[model samples]
Target: MSPEMTRKIFLYGAGGHAKVILELLEVNERRCAGIYDEYGAATQLLGYPVSGNLNDDYKAADSAMIIAVGNNAVRRKLARKLSANWATVIHPSANISSRCTIGNGTVVMAGVSVNSEVRIGDHVIINTNCSVDHDCVLANYVHISPNVALAGNVQVGEGTHVGIGATIIQGIKIGKWATIGAGSVIIRDVPDYAVVVGNPGRILRMNEPEDVAGK
Candidate 1:
């Protein structure tokens, strides 16, 4: 469908984060079809209806979606299961290079800078004021929180959460489902399901396997 014709959006997950995303969509004058969250028993969220749970029937609508769930792995799973042409929401103020590859259902928040040759996978959140340098590969469902700085050639695996104000040095590999604490400085590789904290990041806790997958 033509860009103009593709206007309606069904947002997944109705929570605090979804509210923010909805506000962004409204600022752009985009129509919200509804929301579908497994946890949304509430009739309305952000002045929009909770249509139903996300399923094949819900997926039939022509409207695209932005998966607003905070959990990276859940977002990734939802993105993979979504119907064709999942939506990418980029705030008007986001600075993204033409050479960057942003996948479907991703959101590039306001004031974010994505430099050249960056590959951002599906349902990712590049949050406010974050600076991603050149040659970064962010896998599906990654969330780079506000004010984070990722140097060049950084590889963030699927479902990783780089906390707000965190800094990652160049050429680092952050494994899947890893959680970096806010204000942490990560200078080395992070293992899967690890929670790292402090000035120079180190593993504080290892997440249970089920927690990583939401099982």
Candidate 2:
């Protein structure tokens, strides 16, 4: 059996999103060795150890990690580089249909509801209270922010972020690395690297290369 079965999970960030993920671990009664941040941003988080380097608390074969950052692009970058095994955290309160498929390292936060035929890719985040309807396809590293509502057959591409309180109607397609701003109502398709905002979801700007996918 894999040594990772010992109940310890390692987090790869130290930030507000990390805090929320840490609590999810707590709620599930999982033990965390510490938080690993190469930048040395923090030394402690909610009483858990924060290490500048990935510590030797667990053996490499036993280390199960979850990218705790909120940024979709950064999460994708880290997922590609991090050699550790992954963990997917779904809050106990989340109502995810068994018919849906959630890839490794994904997180379904509290109060979230995912309907049947939904395909959520690796390291995606369905944030608190979000409603993902039937047949939605969420590509890798996508972040569906808190309170966002995705109607049936909606497709969100890689590293796309649907901001808090945003609503996308049925059959909408949002492209890679796109940003749908908070409270926006998406009525049409969004292209890659597009920054969309407002009630009618107008294109505000395009993201630079550094902030986009494959960066």
Task: Tell me, by TM-score, which candidate is best.
Answer: 2
Best by lDDT: 2
**On a 0 to 1 TM-score scale, where does candidate 2 land against the true structure?**
0.94
Q: Write the per-residue lDDT of candidate 2 for residues 1-215, one digit (tens) a residue.
A: 44434657899899999999999988987778778888857889998878887655543665678899988878888888877678888999999999999999998899999999999999999999999999999999999999999999999998998999999999999999999999999999999999999989999999985857767
Which sections of candidate 1 miss by over 4 Å? 1-5, 53-61, 80-84
lDDT for predicted candidate 1 compared with the true structure = 0.85
lDDT of 1 by residue, 1-215 (tens): 56734667778888888988998887777777778877667778866888656655435556677887888768767766766457788888989999999987888888999999999998889998999999999998889999999999999988889999999999999988889999999998999999999989999999886878665
Question: Which regions of candidate 2 are displaced past 4 Å?
Answer: 1-6, 55-59
